[model samples]
Target chain A: MALVDDNLTAAGVAMEGEVSDYLALLKPRVMSLVVFTAAAGLLVAPGPIHPFVAAIAILCIAVGAGASGALNMWYDADIDAIMSRTRNRPIPSGRLDRQTALMFGLVLSVFSVALLGLAANWFAAGLLAFTIFFYAVIYTMWLKRATPQNIVIGGAAGAFPPMVGWAAVTGNISLDSVVLFLIIFLWTPPHFWALALYKQSDYAAAGIPMMPNVAGERSTRNQILVYAILLSLASLLPLATGLTGWVYAVPAIGLGLVFSGLAFKLWRAPAEQMKRNARELFTFSLLYLFALFLALVADVGIARFLEMIS
Target chain B: MTAPTEPEMLSKEDSDKLAKSRRGRSIALALVLGALAIVFYALTIVKMGPGVFNRPL
Candidate 1:
């Protein structure tokens, strides 16, 4: 991982002097979802964490995610340049050098993991370390270029943040945390496959074998529908297991139905209408995830309010 | 280790950019070190409990 200075200099000076380029390397939009879900995990865990400590834990998670993003950009620069959606990324656009990104990611990864261990527990820190490794190496380096199930398996990296957050407070994993993990893990394929359906040509051009590129669109749609049904069931597990109250149960079940319905609609869409269906499913998938996690947080808040009133 | 002093080969603009970058790096390093110090302090306080930093006087 020690990228040589000469190799970086060959890419020439940065095209832009703005710090936003560095921030862009972090994939902040994705990081926001990681932070939000991690916060929900931290909140709904059994024990209390000092607010300051909770802040630090979230910060560490966010930084770890950013580290993963930078490393991914560094490694995927070649394919990124070929894909229109990613061509203007900091590295491929020449706003930042690959070596600089490599160093930035490495330094942040070490700092976040170490700081989390100090602030929380070794288990949480270890989970975070694994997450960074999984995204940067397991997913970006290997699976992305290798198989159609790349996102399916690699989704675990995104799923781990909530578990890490839960562990930060509990110092151990539990069934509840696993449920949270399962929700995101199962949600990943359908969410990404919808985007993949519309962006199939981009992946083909980049030589990346996303599901829509490798599998026929019909097969991919069928698989997505199956995952969507499974995801709906997983989303309701929290309430079924009595981990959360009705505040979460009602919306969780409702969103799950809507999510599955969208998937079914996409599956039934004609070839000419597939892209439009995919875009609709993709848009709703984001809302589906945010709403599910928000329900979890809202349940805790409502319980606290009732406790105070009584 | 200490950072190298002004280099011989860089143009004025490049030198300015290098200086600016060094300054930014230094400030960031200081902030991180400062935050770590506070976190360690907070952890110590938590470990020691309420009265550790307090005095009747």
Candidate 2:
């Protein structure tokens, strides 16, 4: 029976081809956000890292994120192959094989963790390792398929980059780090849910019960509005805690307002108009988070410059 | 850049894709080794004290 199950599994697996297939396993776009957020953590932290070391830390973050993406791809390939939106991904598109993605993820995971440990303190290195585990094992293998609450709980994995970034620089977590963490954590649901709204059938057809597909679109949009309000309120924490200046403040407020407005628009949308609003909100939320973090980096940079000139 | 002369000669172009695939692993190896060398030089040879990780702002 066991051998038969193994044979069945092997037979069920899809074969993929091409070099870009392997590259696609890395989810480069999501890795970019991870790299940027982690870089901001390092840049804004209260200490100095040698330029080269800082770059290495960022590289380690990129690699770890890439590894997580690969692991996610490896596990999700089954469902991903079913979803129209995701069917072109490496494993699903028959460009890269599943076992190859598995090996690639494992190799990159070990290399990233070991190199981060050697390049920086064990504190930062350990956090990176844990992040890989959380995303790959906890979220991907466990929560995502098991629960509609998956993203809400598993969002912590995505939110950890800035904290890892802070640790890379300071080797400790702070209120500011927590604030940054909270911002991303709160932001995740609204960001992902909007996509879920637009991609409901893809998710439903894939047998992944995304909230919009399971609970209904109205409920999903309402949740998006709630998370957006909570996210907007959460954005104010960084400024309130003194981690950001007006550079981050003005734009955060502006961005948060627009984000909330979009959520409101999404909430009030007619059924015909709902998916369009969700798509726009989904796209803009990514930009909103990137801009918020960039603004933080700039504010801190300018503050440091002023301090030096004075 | 320039107003696009896009796809003026699609069929005649060099198959750089072939060379890129053939050379990709070597290029990646070189980058990795070079990075390792820089890390080694920075940490061991130059003897710069561990750079300040973070100082309270």
Candidate 3:
């Protein structure tokens, strides 16, 4: 009887992971942003791609981003359990076990990369694979715990999707794609530092060494302002490179000013009001990136339409 | 050391829930596989064009 009971348990007769639990592991909110940005990259590229191929590239990028999220969740489950913001994630919440999450992430990562190679060019596929590795191994395992500059460098993983999308269409990186990469890369520091400001206690408890907890809030706020200024300037590179016209340029400049303005307010905010200001900046940063990318796509579409009519 | 004890068995309700979860996962997996097949078939058709069917054996 004991032997039979052990066999059933070994066969996962007690497994309780639901579909939603698996989905939550993917960090769908982040995946949505990745999908939007990747699609923007694909749409704004110089040459045309079959609609079907473009769809596949976007799907692969989304899945690859989700896979990395799962792997991050698996590795960070311990810290996640300690941090209030992450305490309810699948692994930390006990909705799914670590091994199950790890296996799921690995399987999805492999399938997404392989399918992307088969569907798109291998260069794009290679970029997807590197993005996954950088997120799972470098950011999650090493830099996240090792440095206060975690998100500063770890931001590269999140920034790669748009470049991968561009490569999927062009089969090579270009100055335009690099500009897109720079925009997000610069945006990450201010964006995450804002969140870190409000969630300082959580990182402290988790021993994660986020910028706000490691550097004083004053210093962190200073850094955020600097990055915001740099991001504002980088957002205009599309115009300099002729990738976008005043349509994108106007909105990019407007959004960047607002982003910088918020960061400036957050910097000068009194200690008593710091958290509120940080929260405000964090919320607007999301809209800023989304709007900036949307403006780029619209600008490119308008340009192409006018050329076609002429 | 004492002999190892028998593993605890799940209650009927818990067993039913587990079974349902497993079924849901299976269905999700099946749908994903089906979608993959459609993507591959469409890609092959798009890449090769109508001439794909006329290729010499």
TM-score of each: 0.88, 0.86, 0.96
Q: Give the per-residue lDDT digits (tens) of candidate 2, residues A119-146.
A: 7778999999999999999999998988
DockQ of 3: 0.56
The regions of model 3 sitting more than 4 angstroms off are A1-15, B1-4
Candidate 1 local lDDT, residue A90: 88
Name the lDDT value of residue A254 in candidate 3.
92
lDDT of 1 by residue, B1-57 (tens): 998753234456865675676576677668878988888898768757778859776
Hey, what RMSD does candidate 3 come out at?
A: 1.9
Q: Is candidate 1 or candidate 3 better by TM-score?
A: 3
Score candidate 1 by DockQ. Answer: 0.13
| Local accuracy of candidate 1 as per-residue lDDT tens digits, A1-310 | 2443332242234542346677898999999999999999999888878887888999999999999999999999999999999999988988788888999899999999998998889999999999999999999999999999999999999999999999999999999999999999999999999999999999999999898888799999999999999999999899877788999989988998999999999999999999999999999999999999999999988888798899
Name model 1 segments beyond 4 Å from true.
Answer: A1-12, A15-17, B1-37, B46-57
Candidate 2, overall lDDT?
A: 0.85
Report how far residue A209 has shifted in candidate 1, in Å: 0.7
Candidate 3 lDDT tens digits, A139-217 = 9999999999999899999999999999999999999999999999999999999999999999999999999888899
